[model samples]
Target: MPPIIDPTKCTGCGVCVDVCSEDVFFGSKKGKVPVVTYPEFCVHFNCCAYECPEEGAIKVRIPLPLQLLYKGGDR
Candidate 1:
């Protein structure tokens, strides 16, 4: 699944668009919330969510199966 951008928090800075390698927000404009253009191409990289300047702006949910397989970020 693609990352969900919270319109309430997003400043339309286009940082997410620049950081994402998947071109998920290809058509989004400079002063508008990004659009999830190609959901099927999403790799669940979590880069967009991590790089978002505003807290709670971007949320990327990893499927349960993939969560179990990766076993990362455990501290």
Candidate 2:
């Protein structure tokens, strides 16, 4: 799934844009929210969300298959 940015919480620090290696998002100017230029290009790696300093600013959905694997540890 593509990353979802929470406008209310986002600081527009461009950390997400800078950290996204897949280039799924386009960088914005200083203090501007980054744009999701290629949502489909998102590989669900979550680098952007992980690196974002703003809490709840961004959310990335993990793929179901990967989610299952991740949840497997809960067993």
Candidate 3:
């Protein structure tokens, strides 16, 4: 699965857009959170998630081993 953005926690910082190695964010405004422009480039690297200031706002697919760390266990 691709990354999903939670607007509530999003500070509209636009850091995700700026740090993206690939041009994945297509939003016009500077502060507007970028949209998933190139889903294929995501690669589940969690780059955007790491840059985001708000917790749980930017979520990328977790790696298999780490997935078990999320309580309730990996699905």
The TM-score obtained by model 1 is 0.79
- Record all residue pairs in model 2 with backbone atoms less than 3 Å apart, i.e. clashing: none
| Per-candidate TM-score against the hidden true structure | 0.79, 0.75, 0.69
**Model 1 bad stretches (over 4 Å):** 63-75
Error of 3 at 11 (Å): 1.5
lDDT for every model?
A: 0.85, 0.81, 0.74
**CA RMSD of each candidate after superposition:** 4.1, 3.4, 4.9
lDDT of 3 by residue, 22-73 (tens): 7567653577766787766676777888988888998886545445444575
- State the lDDT of candidate 1 residue by residue for 1-75, as single tens digits: 668888999999999899889888888899899998987677888888888899999998776556665556867
Error of 3 at 64 (Å): 12
Q: How much RMSD separates candidate 3 from the native structure?
A: 4.9
For TM-score, candidate 2 versus 3, the one ahead is 2
Best by TM-score: 1
Question: Which consecutive 10 residues in model 3 have the weakest lDDT in total?
Answer: 62-71
lDDT of 3: 0.74
**Stretch of 10 with least lDDT, candidate 2:** 66-75
